[model samples]
Target chain A: MSSTLLRTTPALRGALRASGALKATGALSSASFVRGKATLPDLPYDYGALEPYISGKIMELHHKKHHQTYVNGLNSALETIAEAEGKGDLSKAASVAPLLNFHGGGHINHSLFWENLAPASREGGGEPDGALKKAIDSDFGSFDTFRKQMNTALAGIQGSGWAWLVKDKSAGTLNLVTRANQDPVTGPYVPLVGIDAWEHAYYLQYENRKAEYFEAIWNVINWKTVAARFEKS
Target chain B: MVSLNTVWQYLALQSPLQLHSTMMSGDSFNLIKMGVTTFALPALPYAYDALEPHISAQIMELHHGKHHQTYVTNLNKALESHIAAVAAGDVAAQIALQQVIKFNGGGHINHSLFWQNLAPAGSDETKLEQAKELVAAIERTWGGFDTFKNAFSTALLEIQGSGWGWLTREAGSGGGLRIVTTKDQDPVVGGDVVIFGVDMWEHAYYLQYMNGKAAYVENIWNVINWKTAEDRFLGRSEEKNEL
Candidate 1:
């Protein structure tokens, strides 16, 4: 992750280091430039570690196949955009927006998602503590309440998308929001925790019973990572 | 004997000639001359609530009016931009627009066929007996209707992401019934006759069925319009008899 952080600014690198997110090495490259290639990151834990809650099969496919596609797509879109812009083909460059948004968002979202998970035997599941816990309680009533609300948001998503627990920078408040497809959490809201609602995330294990997947995933959620992100935000 | 596949192959070759004429024509910016057709949402043949219990009215309204309509709307918008790009000879822009066109266009095509593929839950069209030829083919291919149903259901469940399951027939001689799947709004193309397609996207069943996908797949048979499938299946035979 530190090596990949080479693409980002020093301030972002500092923030990431402070948040303890740097330990999930190789999970993200932030943004890869035209010449930079976004590669698949190494998971902090083994695939089978998140078992019972999220099957190893699902994890392997999600991380390898799905995430790899997004990485390849994002790198390709960035290359195309750079080439088009170099040719002074502004229209052609602009036309690549959808691909950039889809693939780029996918890459960012999955990178965050992997860090937010851990094996149940480790720092996974359980409630958050310290400043992060206080924020969750204050903004969303109680931890239990916030969990239920997040689950509800996950269920409400139509087609394929994600439900994120985000923080409003100005207000210092936590909010739950949903994004259609791979539309990443951006703007003023800093995404602290994201749960994938796309069918591929859970279809193999939970089938169409997505609510179970949503509910069960919490068992493997690395609160430490989320807390770090929340505190940093 | 001229096989249904050969007849379809002959017809398929004619499209490129028409497309070539449209491209070669000097009418710049003429959408009509380019043969770019604007797609519209087709009205459902039955009432929204007609497939109640199996598929709720709310789901139908949203699936047809909202979901399907969005596809039609976006596809038209993409086509408009695509035509402009073509006129400007912006090949890169045109290439970029291809994906959007494919996604939205496939959505429109799939949903249009999906609506017609279903009848009222207990209606006469739902009966397998009504589609004798298709039923016979199913029996011939899979040995029984139940076996075919199970296979179709399994395929629908196996789709990893958003997609559709279809029963299609190959064109020409030696081609027979086959089951296939397409991911993320990809419509069935080529020489195959699409007997029917079942929408596997979560929006198709999530609201009404709510994660009970197997149940949704099971109940879908109750509303399947086998009559339409029979007609599509026997179309070539009917033409052959005329000849």
Candidate 2:
């Protein structure tokens, strides 16, 4: 609605489509952080802290071991790939491609996943205080409509990846998007919420049944933290 | 009368503590020999029979006793195996097991809370003040309650096979109520963090709604404790006061 909408960098725009003024993660979304270049941050809460929604066992495994593995593998791949490139062994680096994709993806995805995790009981998915709600209402005709749009977008994702609620900084509204594989949501938007679709992220207990898993997780989304993010960033 | 009393006393004597302890001592001996500790199912807050036709006693039995038990059993098994993996010097196996441990473990953990989230068969709430706040918020954002319901129902209606629909608040972008979905095994709390949500997985509704997801979602409207949800939504605001 304002003259500054689309020009606010991809970080401050509208839905990248059903989902708000989508904004992106600045250069973080576009740039590749090599193995040596990055680190997995320690969590504010203990591995067991998110219990009930995500068990202590799951958190321990997901963080200490699984995500750490990605970090370790990422470190290995980047150093090796860089060496290969130095020797002009293009083919060697080419062979190293999957390593980078897999490990790098693991690191990136897990890092993103951590920021999203928090105790919902305390946080309450932060309410949209003002403008975000207003825009959502105007664009989708109501907040409920926006939610429905996001749900449809998430349920539609096939295989592993993510569903995003982004502020399309350009359009200045929230939008829903499904990313294929570990493809980052790199458009002109900022991430507000991301739902992981990796089979490993769920499976096991849910078995081949994904719908049940989807249905159970609604109990824990933290709205309070989200609202704060909207206020500051 | 005296003879009958004597007879009852004699019958009680047959089942005395002395006899019971002597017999049960064998179980202690066996436990000492095997060194296994017992773990029992945690009791539910309400009786299984409490929530009647809305949620059948049979389903609660299976869900709590059978399904939940299986998770606990498997989790313990997985933990034991993980300890073995560490002892046997199989780092790779240990790492591999991590995924299953967490996934199954999380499944067990999440569902336990979920069972409590639902009302046991009987009745529901008016949610008075909370409903008024929520209704006002909805009206401000979407015009009225019907619009919000239609929109929310639309979300519940469109699950891709299995997942959850959340009314989450995201930070930095005004705390607008956002609806989002997550795939199988993926929890909003872990990856996206949900404040509260509706389970759209067929298990949540199959027994009740069958393939009619739309109908199941619509019916849920009657059950939602707006008061509970409102408290959660307002939870963060309370924290700000401390600062």
Candidate 3:
């Protein structure tokens, strides 16, 4: 939350200069100078707001502990890459690519996931309408069928993963797919709705009976945000 | 599709050292790697359908052939890359390679133990009498065999994500028995001797048990290779001499 935007803070710049990584040019916009650290975004609603479907405790833990860890991890991985780059250690920076991908995808996935959820009393639940609904019905046959297929995808994940409703960029159609672990939905697809299948996402409330949690989560899905994303994409 | 008995005969004659290393330490990677080595998917001793009615043939086929094989394959690739990185003094590459090695290496190690940790249900090897020393130790720790089983089951069920549950002997001259859990694919490290391990990952039982993890946990006992547990706990005299 501090005003410092660049990763090359005084201490790091000093360290780099001391290591002779920074030559006498003193260039400010060097490619090695990492810009803007990623920070945890504020939840659109209160943690307890999505209660009854997802418990207040679960939401608090998911947001404060789990999602925050991803944020921290993403920032840390980026910082490590920056540090390595500053020290002219491209091999070390490249080695951190997996951590960067995992943590970065986790952050993006959780951020999108939180935005697409709302209280049942608010814009949550019900079916998508307008162009989004029409696209779903066209691509997946119907809204009900799409939901069933997504839920099935959620259940069929072999291990920790995410089931996503993605917008195929070329076809402009909706498709359901699953990604193992924190792998983000990428490659010619823009993720619309991502349902985390990792046990930690629902374990405290659902335990091994994940299907119930899968069913309950629909009650709080914000189709409005999903529509906006669809429209934007 | 080798028969367990046939595999046992082959093991007794030609592969006792490999078997003993896998059963004793779950560190067969080091034992097999005298130089640069490519880890292979170990052949299942029993037929895929051998543990059927408890775990299905489909589950075994995929779990071993597909899932475990992927780990072995990836671990080999990662190790080769790591060797190159080390030669080039690529510190970043070596550091990055650490996680993949652990994940895949632990997968190979754990699955190797997991395969031998089980026998076909109702087999003589499943009987606790085959592991008398371990049972006595379990009783001393938890006061009864059923109690220890219950405790271990609780630990397995309570795992929040993909992981493994293990019964290990603390390292040292007179290490005691303990129940522990490792997240993801982390192996039982710190010199602890893994007597047995239960895979809690969904792939291990989802095809057979689905979300009924409790049922999977309960029935797993029916196939537990207690004799292997005994050998691990007792440090079998012959195996000890070989080591």
Candidate 4:
């Protein structure tokens, strides 16, 4: 299965393209297609860019090893589905749907994750200004309150998962949500920011101290990119 | 006297043993007639250490005492909130609670079934008459015990993330057996009655098996309580036949 076929449905691609987040982040451009195979999107910055807050070791392993596995799995699952469909074996496709979700979600979430961060030297840390700031204040009371809520929600996840700040397009409001083990933000919500709470994301640096990791993550958040995502949504 | 409708409802809702007991014990009839029941963590049929060498005592302790207990607790909590939401007609709240209910409820159901379907190796229960019937069925459906084991293990290993692999009797397929897998803690429900299931969740095997899930899959066969699986298969088949 090619990356193009596996990464997103045609509908999802249209949504992403419309949102302009995919274009803005240059994720679509960086995506190298070898015979339409799904390839890992290159990190926008150096692996060590978010160092001190997130060790370069973690970023390297996460991006190279962890993210790559999902790419492989997603492509494999897509191939399986295609072959099953070719044989008119829908049961085989149904059985492998979980893999598609898990791996495809992994690829999507991590792709967003890499773009969601920037170096502290690059105005990564600090508060959002303009419409994004006003939306935050209006929806979640204030920036501090939003931060606290996100931290609490992220810390409360029982297992490997992610915490998201998503735009509910229908209601036109920002909401905080959590998903377990590579489940993407589905439905009407367009994800603006996501924090990986999986053990691999922080175990080496924080060692079960999820609160500390969550706290440190804020320092490296690329607020400008998040603002762009919010605006696009 | 309970209304005839209430009796019919009770018969529809209650488990076989509960129904049988309700019929036998007049004092308990009124309580069950009102439709109040809660799930609890069942006692392990054998000592925690009984399946050691194949599965560690520590793994059993945490898997049952900690993991399974947490699921039971959370499921109860979710159900409590769900009941209130349904009573209040809070459809949004009910919708939000669906994942909570499925995760905890499936965890509870799967773990409960998993415990019953395992025993210490070489036990008398391993090869009883009931187990013989199950083996015969396995051979018939899958073309022999070894083939069935291989196919089941392959399915179990292929579960990409946390999930369960089951040998279930397809309800409308004339008692046909199929090996199926489900993601996360989703329970094997619908018309399929699970005869035997293996937990592929990391927590189920991570402590003892680590990343070597193949080893865990291989070793679990040693502890499978074939008699219990046979009983469940026979019981479900009998119920279907009666219907």
Docking class of 3: incorrect
lDDT string for model 2 (B46-87, tens) is: 677554555546545666786557655765566566556544
Clashing pairs in 4: A3-A37, A3-A38
Interface RMSD after interface superposition, model 2: 11.9
What is the full ranking by lDDT, best candidate first? 1, 4, 3, 2
DockQ of 2: 0.02
Q: Write the per-residue lDDT of candidate 4 for residues A41-119, one digit (tens) a residue.
A: 7888888999899989788878998788887887677667666655668888778878878887887888888888999
Report the candidate with higher lDDT, 2 versus 3.
3
What C-alpha lDDT do the candidate models reach, one value each?
Answer: 0.76, 0.53, 0.74, 0.75
Q: For model 3, what is the error of residue A192's alpha carbon versus the real structure, in angstroms, after optimal superposition?
A: 0.6
Each prediction's total of clashing residue pairs, residues at least 3 apart in sequence or on different chains, is 6, 84, 1, 2
Clashes counted in candidate 3 amount to 1
- Where is model 1 more than 4 Å wrong at Cα? A1-233, B1-31, B34-37, B236-243
**Which residue pairs clash in candidate 3?**
A92-B92
On residues B1-243, what C-alpha lDDT tens digit does candidate 3 reach at each position? 212222122223223344334334533343234233446777887999999888988779878997788877887787677656655555577667666667777787778779988999999899888988789889999999889988999999866558899999999987989999997787776567889999998778765665567999988988999887898888762322121
Question: Regarding DockQ, does 2 or 3 come out ahead?
Answer: 3
- Residue-level lDDT of model 1, residues A1-233, one tens digit each, is 21332244343333334334443322234333224456677788988899999889778878987788887886677667656655668788778777767777787888889999999999989999999999889988999999999999998664578999999888879999999888878778898889999977876677656789999999999999998888778
Give the CAPRI rating of model 2.
Answer: incorrect
Better of 3 and 4 by DockQ: 4
Model 2 chain B poorest ten-residue lDDT run: B1-10
